[model samples]
Target: MAKVGRIKLGSQGLEVSAQGLGCRDLSGPGKPEPDMIALVRHAIDIGVTFLDTSDFYGHNANEVFLGKALKEDEVREKVELASKFGVSFADGGNKVDIRGDPEYVRAACEASLKRLDVDCIDVYYQHRVDTRVPIEVTIGELKKLVEEGKIKYIGLSEASPSTIRRAHAIHPITAVQVEWSLWSRDVEEEIVPTCRELGIGIVAYCPLGRGFFSSGAKVAERFSENDPRKRLPRFQPENLEQNNTIFERVSEMAKRKGCTSSQLALAWLHHQGSDVCPIPGTTKIENLNQNIGALSVKLSPQELLGLESFVAADSVKGDRSAIGLATWKESDTPQLSSWVAA
Candidate 1:
């Protein structure tokens, strides 16, 4: 196997492995605990030193899984652990709410720390931008956590270009986590450029397009009843049928390149720039190994252009997610001078 590489996130000098492990589904209703722990430890053994999880994932169960996975003092020191807050669950995890108030921010951080059983998180993020709260105020509280050693660096997720700038002005943002893939190029419009100019690294989540690009439309039907992607517009039957072109094109390219479609998707993100890192999550070690192999698939300039042109000609047919949900579109806004006016 080729040696896995590492990249520095922004100017904070926080280094993470080139391919981070997204731990959202590692532990869940159907996932076995021992298997999940073994997968995490295996990832570390192979140099995948960055782990991404959210406090809201599995309704706080994911962090607890990590706590058990990395219980050993020496094992915990090998990875750069990142987690997010700002989203709260209600009505038994059916209803979702976004909160960024100073009080909630503090409370959320404390809760995450306890759940993960860690003294401090390496990178803490506001999972979703709360349009009602001023970006400055939200980041200001994070800055205090950094000062007090609760978190080493700050990050934002699904934030707009304007919001990113506003937050960065208050304090340097180490990274911005957003869904960026062949099927999700909206970020390239403004978010990517802004982060580049501001020296903020991008942690691309869902880089496989929620398994759509790799598994094709048929995968949509296999989603569990509770799977969140079932609610996404792109996964609907009509949209999925229309989006088959994307899968076909990517599959063709992967065959020519001698890589799996999933690997091709990840390699595309890798080719974008050194500042972009995609944290592709999976419960199976085979899938994890395939994701890691993406680093080795090189694309020629013509091949890259061909893929881009193919996507441009046969664009994805639906919104990334259902409207009115907490998403990148909802977070795009100019900085507010007062939260009261928002």
Candidate 2:
């Protein structure tokens, strides 16, 4: 078991492991389910007190899988559960349907609670900004649930800075979920800074760029015909070829530092600030343990700066996302704000 790294979540009373586990991809389409139970349990045994899941991941498959894993003997109390709402599965496939109405908010939370088989959620986040419904009204209903003892904290995911500020004003946002990494530093300027000023924690998803940082996982495999990574611009031929150079350097640094590329990447993200926690998601036990190993690899500011410069110097290869998906929920800057949802 890895030793836990503790940090305060926003202004809330809960303290969690600095490196949490993201459970979305475990049971989602194109992932292996046989590995999820042991993988999640392995995370819990290794000081991963924070576990994040969402209802939209495969039409509630992620939540139901988590429920079964949580029922393991004496494992339920070991983790702090974070679930999300505001995005529903309109069809059985991959499409987000926004529903932030107060009634819908309550209903979504209830469904997530039932799926997770938990009495109260440690953290409940809106999966995305429902531009139709005012964020304040969403918070109003979430706060009502807080008063009702159904929720512990409110969060927003992939929202703009203005939305974050507005939502926080309505209620103290304990944490904001966003895809922030060395590769995805889009949250540095206002979103992350604002969270710091306001004392909210940043839960960095995709800390590994969806397996881009793993030890033996090469960029070439992602370009395979059936792989979804091919659909992402960053994984295109030219972009992938150039980006692999960055990975090469990352691998070199990892060898020099006596760790793997994934560990170095996760360590750097965790060491960025005490308020930031990176929940690098993985479905393989080896990858899960490798990620947790990051808690012990403390990087100095100088090393972090060096890595930043190296990444910047290396051509980013391609845009992180495609046209609409690249937008990441309507932001207009290289750096944008983030909010929470589940």
> How do all models score by TM-score?
0.96, 0.90
Candidate 1 residues lying further than 4 Å off, grouped into runs, are 91-94, 332-336, 340-342
Question: What value does the lDDT take at residue 130 in candidate 1?
Answer: 85
Candidate 2 residue 32 C-alpha distance from true site, Å: 6.5
The TM-score obtained by model 2 is: 0.90
Could you tell me the lDDT of residue 296 within candidate 2?
80
Clashes of 1: 0
Q: Tell me the tens digit of each residue's lDDT in model 1 across 201-244.
A: 99999999998866899788788887889989888888877788
